[model samples]
Target: MKKIIEGKIWTAVCVALTLLMIVSAIWIGMRYYVSMDIYQTPSMFLEGEYSVDGGEWKSIEKDRYITDHFHKIVFKGKMSKKLLMYFGSLTISSKNVWYTLKTSDGTVIQSYNFDDEKLSYEHTQTDKPLALDMPNTPGYCVKTIYPDYLTKTENITEDSDLIFEVEYPYSYALVSYNDCVDVTAYYNEGMYLRFFYDALPPVLLFVLICFFGLFFFPVASFILGKIDYKYLTFGMLSFLWGLYMIMQQISGYLNLWIVDPTVCMMMDKITGYCFVAAVLFYFKANMSSRGTRIAANIASAAYLSCVFTVFILHLCHIRDLNASSMTMNFATAGSIVIMIVLLCVEMRINRNALFFLLSWVPLLLTVAIDAVDQFIHLPGSHYFNYGLAITMIVQIVRLIGDLRLQYKEAIRHQQMQKELYEAKVSVMTSQIRPHFMYNALTSIAMMCEIDPKIAKEATITFAKYLRGNMDSLKQTGPVPFTQELEHLKKYLYIEKLRFDDLLNIEYDIQATDFVLPLLSVQPLVENAVKHGVGMKEDGGTVRISTRETETAYEVVIEDDGVGFDINEQKDDGRSHVGMENTKKRLHDMCGGEVKIESVVGKGTTVIVILPKEGQPNEDTLS
Candidate 1:
């Protein structure tokens, strides 16, 4: 027991320390390579090549300086009509502002103006060519952070000097290309598949891995027997959370028309709220306390009501999509507190809850911290996904362990029922033959006239033998070796009176610390005398020996008489029933086995092997 406890502690420490090292390493490396790998090239724009508002042209390395305003960048460029002249891979949407391009001679080539309400695309407000089929809503440009991201390519007819301008209400706009390089040439120029590496966001990757990892628990549970409710609840919760993460990183959908952006945002809100409800229900599923679970259900219903109200209001244009997140985050914080209290209440009343609580407490605390972070507003708070992903991994591993242990316990319970039934059947199988009973009664009746004292002794012995055999029906588990030996002596005494000088009995008991199933070994002795020695006119000796080795206890029952072939098939009515019953009883009640060796016209040897170190349990002993 101590060894098992120590092993668990060591395993937990090793896993915790290992995860700490991995997360630390990844966080440090990601800090260096997150946005730099895609844009840090020799072809990047130089400081003196462009100017804003006719001032000195200074290079902008960071993405936060250009927020909520208009800036016109005038740069000198000598471009041949044969090469493509364009600037694309911008991460901003076109709703807040638009961009236009014109040459030094004031001839406008292309312009997109979704930001201005006064001008329409069909109305030639500016002397410029319009991009084809621009959406009324701002079309989101492709995310240049991903390798497969697509962008708009604008061609200039004859532009030696280009004036580039951005009018947006945001601080950051990722500029992937500022020169005349096409997507095909850019993909081949750099390190092989460098854009692919840039596409791999660490948090999104973890979320995807968790989506598959959380599903393994229910699969394992299903194989064990029935799937658990907690597994279903937690699995769905994890899937929805992963979906929320994926939707957050998706860049351009307005241009793609796969689904409306409004619908996508609505789905995000719906899934997020559903995940919150599922988490509360997950705890409620495992809860043993009726009052606590009921309270949790009410809390869950109330939270869901709030979420649904917000969702409906947002869909009806009563509230925008981003506005509901604050309300939901606050509600999530309230739900977390409610659960914390309920968990404590449950832990105090139910000891079985310790297993769930020990690992779950930290995860809940992390969730609470995350919920608060949404309102508190911390720098680099975008990386909260790291903590969430790690917690989910730990929770899944712990849940699997708990479910497997529960499965084993259920199997053990079923085995006990079977062992008890086998014990009862074994007692019935070891019943003394009716012929022996009639012969013993006849001898006792005859002895009463010849010797009254001998007759009384024989009657008492016969009564003891009958009582012992019947008493065995009530004993479903193992008995003491001493008690079993007394029953054996009573049966032998009755048999000896019938076979006066023909039958011989011997006993050798070398071990007595362990226990065996009631009537287990006695049946083997009965089988030996009835089928082996009793078959001969001059009955042979029956020997019963008990001994022990370092790891197991042994009982050998031997008879010197005409023995039947062990390989032969057993008939319907036979003496082999006792031996077969004993074998099954020994195996089912304890971790033991029986081996029978015999030869035709020779002798039979039956050995019962029981483990020495095995302590009898409820089913193994009374």
Candidate 2:
């Protein structure tokens, strides 16, 4: 269970599942807001007459089913004066007046001219075409309620010639004058809700995700990651696309002053192409395959050429949007499908990146649904710009996923650095221990000349001391508690030879099976004898004890000797490197801890705590 829990494959799966849960939660929350109320349409519609010309009310084209691109139809019949009329495109008055309501004899009853931050206009001759106030935002946004709905009193005669023009080739084009205006309002609300969520919040969310506080995080990430990121490109794309969608949703009132739907479609096409191009750039920026790069570059150039060509034709007053739209949809859809396939292939080869590619699944679905909707024309299916907003969200998720991988990589790098440090410290302590070994050997050599029997016994003990130190160096993993204790005992026996009766040792060994880093306890014992005991004329006792507790195993090395002040800004010029190295290795290798306490001229105690279980998961480095 422990192995499975900590395994790499399971860790990745856990992360993916966690992210999916969070995304699902958020999606449910958004669905709640997008469906604040169930808006239902009334069961009836208003009916009115259409005429091709003022003289022929029953002419062949009098039914005036004009729709789609540049359409001019005349509605010159009477209806309920207690009526509500709205245009989804820019409108004109034959009298060179801004929108006006006249009685039967042509006496204007009410007139309105719009020009403000949200709307503006230019009345030339008898044409009333208006532009929006937002910069680089080419469109019309005029929404005016002729008279408050509350002002409706009695029925009277009404007549007007309404012309309609839009960008997207209409799937259904029919002049609709619903006699039941109340039903139209409720019907539109239901339709709009069904199509999409509120555009304002989604747009704002994408903006924040892209910039993350004035582009601080995105800019820093770009520099640190060294990739030609497309966050800004996608952000602009969503911004324009969102505006275009919002205009369509509030068309009757919001954009009645704007010149036709041409502006809306133009904006959509331009940004859509730009968005597709940015995707190509993102692929090139992060890709390694030269062939893929060449292909994406060619595709991007082709898309740019087509978009620019269509834009030039539109600018020159040649307004046909169908051909360009068809081309754009096919090209964009094909490119996205190819990209998705490539990501899937990459994921198969590198399962470590499975979660990373999973982040693009939402974007791929959006592309596929839009492709089928545009090309197949399924009557039973109608998709809105919700996918457009969701695509931006997926990109944000991708960014977050990339950052997560980077964070993990950073943590791995840090672990490697720590291991290297531990090796370096081990080598340092090994060097210092050899100096102590030489001193002990020297003492034995002198004893050999004076007392040959003592020297022989000392030589046998020296072999054990040397063997213990070499064993510690050979095995990087911790040894059993008893094994380490034996090494310490061998070390103390060698030191006792030089100090004879001056060195006294005591043991209160209780722990039996807990594992600890090699040589972790020996150095503390060596320090007690060398620094604490050797400082006094009357040598002291070095007491070593170990106890097993519920959580951890505690080991204490105490010495009754002339101890130095721990906080005194003074040293014995020895550096005390071995004691420090032992403390660090114990804690880092085994989830252990070390603490030291001392009183001047009294005694010193060094306590070590080792976790009483399986080896420490080294990732939890202290």
Candidate 3:
């Protein structure tokens, strides 16, 4: 059970099941509450006729731009019995106007208004579209109140003509009247409930993404104590994008609960601008090339400058913020182009760039499609929200992959460090054997009275040899061959004092400018003196030599004493751990190798080979 809990496959299965449950729940809710009988017809306004200020009547278009809000608009249309039977209510929704419903002969029905006073328009056609001053409250937002029991209304007949007297009296609003209007026909109460329910899942997904971006990632980074700027910027990108997407999905319903509708509009605008800036910041943070980072920085600065300029102009009453929509669109499009180009260039060199491109391109394309749909007043499908969900999933997967790589690398680094430390400890202990120390010190003490001059020399050499063994413990890597040779000579000098003429020493020097693991060669020389020569009655010569090959530098230690069979394992209760550690270190540190050749009653030979710079070790190559 513990192993299953710890396994990655189990975690993946849990996540998949959780996601499936969430999706199934949403689907069940949607299928249960939403009515299939709900349908839409072409807006009734398309068949009506409108007269501006009692002037000539013109056929109403699918969409109308009303530039002359100072005049009254009288819209005339007829209600059919079939239309009234199917739809329980009709909503004439708009942010720019308030209207009264009346019969064609001019009998009043109902009036929708927050205040009775006429609105004052401060500017005319001379200035850009202006934001008029209005009460900063939810009451100021236009509310739709369709008549109850419309099919049974007393004033209505099967072919009764209705008149809509519209006025923009609260403000000098100049905009596409159709942009904010929705002439939706509700069949039943279920339609209203379904309208909000349809948006619930997308809103929930975006909110979850926002929570992770604004709180989870940043807090995790802080706790880890490694401040990765890329994750920070990614979090910012996620937050702004998520907020923007959420607003796009449900900002209309949000107005009903907010203090000020205009504040929501401003927040929406700011989120859009900041979302673009976040993308550039995330790109800059992730870039490895200085040129790419600089490019992203400059692009971000330019985009921010445009956003600030638009806001400044809006605040100064030079222009309304909505009037600069074209400029904002161009800026957003330009940033998209730049990002696509950068990603294309980076994809050739960076593997992660492909993932980034995959995540971003679909979002860009879906947003463009949704933007076009909104601009044309098409029914909302909001494919961009799906794109956002995909982007979030991809980014999460990418982060997990990076973390896995980091974990593996950290484990590998620790393992290598452990092996290196153990190698150093093994070589140190082998060099400072208690028996060799006792014999050398005993020889020195006996010689102190027999020959004081020789005794003093041997004492200093012994001290130096002991110092070398201690120093080897501190070394983490290979040392120069000359340094190892000097340390080895100190050990040999002390050994000669103990084993007088019985132990012979020889040196064949040809190469001295190479490096090997610290104390590497000295251990083999000690093995020769102790195991090969000292066991014989007539102690023989232990020869140390170095020579340069075409591709390597070699150190050879040979002893002309009783040599044991190379294939035979000695069972003298002795562990040859030092030999194994030396071989391991040689291969790990410098790709070097060790070879031994011995025959019973003959001499033994040990060779160490280290590759030359820029040359592959022959042992590794084979």
Candidate 4:
């Protein structure tokens, strides 16, 4: 047990280290190729005066910016000469707000207008394009101050007071920067290439993880059997979480599609809610205690209900999704806290719970940081993305260890079953050999007194029949039907010498193209002649026949002799070893079965049915 645990841990560490090294190598390569030598500086309007709702102007403080809904705030600042000397273009970047750039003479140079009549909330309308100069990433807008555009179009010069009117529905932060290149020049300088490298690697990693979780892991779990449910639930959680991460980077960095900000925002929130619910479901599936599972169930349902309510609110224009984000985060955090407490309880009994704690703790911290970041407006923070990578890596490593253990267990179980089956077959062969030898030798002794020539032939046949039965002791599996039939013919040839005219044998063979257990059918025929026919004063005939059916091949042994009740218990209390052993070996070797139909006054019929599925079809009887 100690060695197994050590091996699992070693494997997990190696895999985790390899994954980290791959990511690090890709990042280093990207950094080497994408140069960060771009010319840029902070704007002169870093300190500005602002007015809220057309009220009196107040001086702006560091890291303190205007934030409100459906309110107009104007910022007034002067463009410096140093910015003009460098032909420096001013860039203003903000999210979830609509504003226009204007000169001191109140001439609007560029406008990104949001129709206030369309929405009761502060979000820009998603029904149509917000404006001509829309950013590819949702909620992100950039306005560049081009040197040529200012002088040619607006005829503005250095130290000009720039009047900015802004209305914020949702605001992150409004920041200004002076750069050497204009908006066109910035894109031409391969800004997209830098963002692609920054975002695509993690997306590719998460996608691969999703493929394993959704497909590979579940297949492994099915083969393992006992741990199937938990693997499926965890797989669902991983897939949904990976999808959420992919969607986060889709429009922002990859820019695969030009999507509305509101649409992207909703998608981000929806996938987040789904994966969180999946997390709760995963806990429920993994929990050993019934009480913990019930608790997890309730938590998952409530979380999904909260998400539904938030969506309803957004759809009805009662409340926006952004307004409910913090509330939802708290709900998610509460579920995580309860799950952690449950994991603590489980860790007391199960060592695997310790591994779960290790994976989840970093995620809990990430969720806490994200809640705080949402409130404080942290710029370009991907704490959740980083934390998710760590958690997924740990969980995947643990899963690989689990699957490896299961494969070993399955192989061990199969070997044990095979050994047990062989032991049973050996015991069955031993039982038939002694009983048949006694009967054949007794018949041969009786025939020697009657005729020397006939007795000599019977002796040779008896010797061959005994040889066949002895050979079966060494046999492991099924033999061709023809082989067993030849042995049966030799047994009957000896029996015919003893019974003479009293015993009559008939054969009606239709099909002889399949395999069955060695020594399986012969015993049934022996019982029919000895017990069924020889019991009467003048013995009756025994007919042996073989035929094919749609689903199986059958050998029938029918005797027109006095039969006994099949349902009655024998007086001796000793079982018929030949019949019972033949039944077992037939079923075990070829998925075949025996059906006995006997009437006390009439006769008996024993049918051996071998299903065609597993039986070999070869070596047709000559």
- Scored by lDDT, the top model is 3
lDDT of each: 0.60, 0.54, 0.69, 0.67
What candidate 2 gets wrong by more than 4 Å, as runs, is 1-78, 84-265, 283-288, 316-323, 337-384, 389-395, 418-622
Off by over 4 Å in 3: 1-27, 30-142, 146-179, 182-196, 212-232, 315-317, 347-359, 364-392, 411-622
* TM-score of each model, paired residue for residue: 0.47, 0.42, 0.62, 0.55
Candidate 4 off by > 4 Å: 1-28, 37-94, 104-107, 111-147, 163-191, 223-227, 251-256, 344-351, 369-384, 434-622
Candidate 3 TM-score over all chains jointly: 0.62
Task: Extract clashing residue pairs from model 3.
Answer: none
The lDDT ranking, best first, is 3, 4, 1, 2
lDDT of 2 by residue, 118-195 (tens): 223423232434322222222323322232231354233244322211121123322122210112222243334433
Report the lDDT tens digits of candidate 1 across residue range 199-242. 33544454654444365445545655677778877777677666
RMSD of each: 15.0, 16.5, 8.8, 14.2
Residue-wise C-alpha lDDT for candidate 3, range 1-622, written one tens digit per residue: 2243236434544654576569568867887976655744234532478777678887765534433333367778766555566666564544435667777777766555435332211112332123333332112233343444544664575577788776654343333444344455566553345455666677776776676677545654543346778778877877887788887666555444443444445556777788878877887776666677777778878889999998887566575455566788789789767866776777767877776777776677788887666446445455777776676677767765765565455556557768878877887787777987888889999999999999999988888888888877778777778898999898888888888998999999898777788888887998899888888888999999999999888999999888888888789897788888889888888789999998767789999998887344445433
Which numbered prediction scores highest in TM-score against the true structure? 3
Q: What root-mean-square deviation over C-alphas does model 3 reach?
A: 8.8
Q: Is candidate 1 or candidate 3 better by lDDT?
A: 3
Given candidate 4, what's the lDDT at residue 12?
47
lDDT of candidate 4 over 23-45, digit per residue (tens): 76887887787665343423224
